[model samples]
Target: MSKSKFTTIGRKILMALSGFFLMFFLLQHLTINMLSVVSPDMFNDVSQFMGTNPVVQFALQPVLIFAVFFHFIMGIVLELQNRRARSIKYAYSKPGTNSSWISRNMIITGLVVLAFLGLHFYDFWVHEMTVKYGGGDMSGLINPNDLDSGYRYHEELVAKFVDPVRVIIYVISFVLLSLHLMHGFQSSFQSMGVSKGKNFIKKFGNVFAIAVPALFVFIAIYHHLQH
Candidate 1:
């Protein structure tokens, strides 16, 4: 292949690798967050452990943050390059109809997800990390860092979903996530040149695409119903 084609191929490989890494991170995050539904104390213990563990705080957390940042930057770079290659114009514009809407608008959904991430950090991370250090009330939870403050972070999360507007937003964002994953999971494999053309691989992807977001939806609904 020519140098340009080789470079394009390499960039795609990087994007796919970064994307899959982020997907794994998402699953880990969701698993931890889902603990809040089972037991507040368990979630608090785990969260506090994650927050206070020396190895995790100094090592894994930084790595996780780097993964998120790298994935985001690569995604933007790839999308921009793709748009430029297409001359920023769609011929028929039926890509959304032909494939999942999330695939067609991954960038848009990613931005929405990014916004929610900010809100999420504000709700939990900022308070947990800062309030204990006398940074003051970021989300007005009152002594958010003191595990003994009876803060009940899980309860706080459920309360947030009590607002109809926020619930709607959460559900909508999750729907976008579902769409995004439907395209993402298989596309990542394709990018890696792992096209086996096997029924099992396709079925696994389909099941994963459906199950993951369904779990998120269930979590959202469960929280919404709690209040």
Candidate 2:
């Protein structure tokens, strides 16, 4: 095969791997968020561990960021190639017939997902890092029922969702994520040549795509209503 063909295949493989890794991260993140709604103390303890864990901070976090960046860059490249192919007069462009709307509009949905991710990092990650590095005054951020806690994980979460605008944006973003995952889940499997038991993969993707995002939306609303 030509170098260009090799590059295309390599890109697709990287995209699929990065996407799968992110999906795992989302599952872990959602589980922790759900815990916050049920048990605030437990949530705080878990958050503290996650924030302070040297391996997670120095290893997994960096790898996760790279996966996100690689997935996004490859997605843009693939989408551009697809667009150029469709622009050719002789190329067939029966998108809906060949694939679902979510699959066709992955670029749009992915962009929305990325936007919310940036907002999320700004809201929480930046603040956490600032406090950790002793640059910001996180003096009064206290958790529920704790006077000595350095950061208020639960309080910060509820405060953000109490804003109706942020809640609406979060809900919309989760919906877009659901749509994106509906196509991406099974598509990733296909790209990686996981053809055995295709029906199971499709069913799992459909259920997971709906359930995970719905759960996340519920978590957001739950926190919003708490305040």
Best by TM-score: 2
Residue-pair clashes per candidate: 0, 0
Clashing pairs in 1: none
TM for every model, in the order presented, reads 0.79, 0.90
Question: Candidate 1 at 227: error in angstroms?
Answer: 3.2
lDDT of each: 0.72, 0.86
What tens digits encode model 1's per-residue C-alpha lDDT throughout 107-192? 88777766776776776677666754466443333255663565456666677778777777777777767666777777788889
lDDT of 2 by residue, 105-173 (tens): 889999999999999899898888887766543333474246676557777788888898998999999
Worst 10 residues of 2 by lDDT: 136-145
